[model samples]
Target: MKQNIHPQNHEVIFYDVNSGYKFLTHSTKTSSETMEWEDGKLYPVIKVEVSSDTHPFYTGRQKFNEKGGRVEQFKKRYNM
Candidate 1:
């Protein structure tokens, strides 16, 4: 493996916007925003739109849009 070819991983905080959930993890992603974590230390915060806390699959609130197949959609679109 080539040296210095990989990005550096740092302890970062991911904040879920929808559920207001926050978690600490290591990632190569960095951010300019900072937030005080539960450990009483500041860490870079990366805001995310969705996380396991609010994700439909994880929350068991997934909605199935089983409106048939492509043919059914086409028919519905044409009012057939």
Candidate 2:
């Protein structure tokens, strides 16, 4: 660990575009866009397409391909 060798880590806001969720955390990433947080402090804002709030796997919305009819074929093959 040397001085001035690492980038600055600052608190930034990550906005989820799909879920409309915003959270503040420390990141080295810099953004030109800034937003006023709940604490009345201005911080860099980064927009993300997906987040845990709206991700399919996290929300348990991942669906098997029903159009393939694979489950039906397997059940029929096994007489189940």
Candidate 3:
């Protein structure tokens, strides 16, 4: 493997915008913004609009219009 070719990964904090949730993870991305973590150390903070905490699929809150489903539409059109 080539040395010094990969971006350095650092401890980062991801803040979910919708849910106000924060988590610690390692990433190659960086930001000028920093925040003090629970350990009292400042880490680069990344703001995200969505994460597992706020995603509809992960939260089990995703809704589909049953009346607009393909199966329902096919059945209605075919008189099934």
Candidate 4:
């Protein structure tokens, strides 16, 4: 570990834009924006577009394309 040459290690907040979910994590990244978390301390808030809270896969809302009814076509083609 070098002395004073390294960037500061600080707590960061990742905010999910879609779900308004936030969590604390440590990073070397810096930001001007901050938030007071449940621990009663201010941390850098970084906003993200997606998180598991609102993600389709995690929410069980994920959709799959029918591929133009390919399943039926495949069964018919195979006569199975």
lDDT top scorer = 1
1-80 in candidate 1: lDDT tens per residue? 78999999989999987667999999999999999999999999999977898778888995433568889989999999
RMSD of each: 8.9, 11.8, 11.2, 12.5
Q: Candidate 1: misplaced stretches above 4 Å? A: 62-80
Alpha-carbon shift of residue 31 in model 1 (angstroms): 0.4
In what order do the candidates fall by lDDT, top score first?
1, 3, 2, 4
lDDT of 3 by residue, 1-80 (tens): 78899999999999986677899999999899999999999999999977888778888995333456788879998999
Tens digit of lDDT per residue, candidate 4, span 1-80? 76899878888998986667888988898689999999898988988777777678888984333334778868878897
Backbone clash total for model 4 is: 0
Which is the leading candidate under TM-score? Answer: 1
Candidate 1 local lDDT, residue 6: 94
The alpha-carbon lDDT assigned to residue 53 of candidate 2 equals 76
lDDT of each: 0.88, 0.84, 0.86, 0.80
Distance from true position, residue 78, model 4, in Å?
56
Sliding window of 10 residues with minimal summed lDDT for model 2: 62-71
- Indicate the residue-level lDDT of 77 in model 3: 89
Candidate 4 has what TM-score? 0.59
Least accurate 10 contiguous residues by lDDT in model 4: 61-70
Q: Clashing pairs in model 3?
A: none
Judged by whole-model lDDT over C-alpha atoms, candidate 2 comes out at: 0.84
lDDT of 2 by residue, 1-80 (tens): 67899889989999987667999999999699999999999999999877777678888894333333779878878899
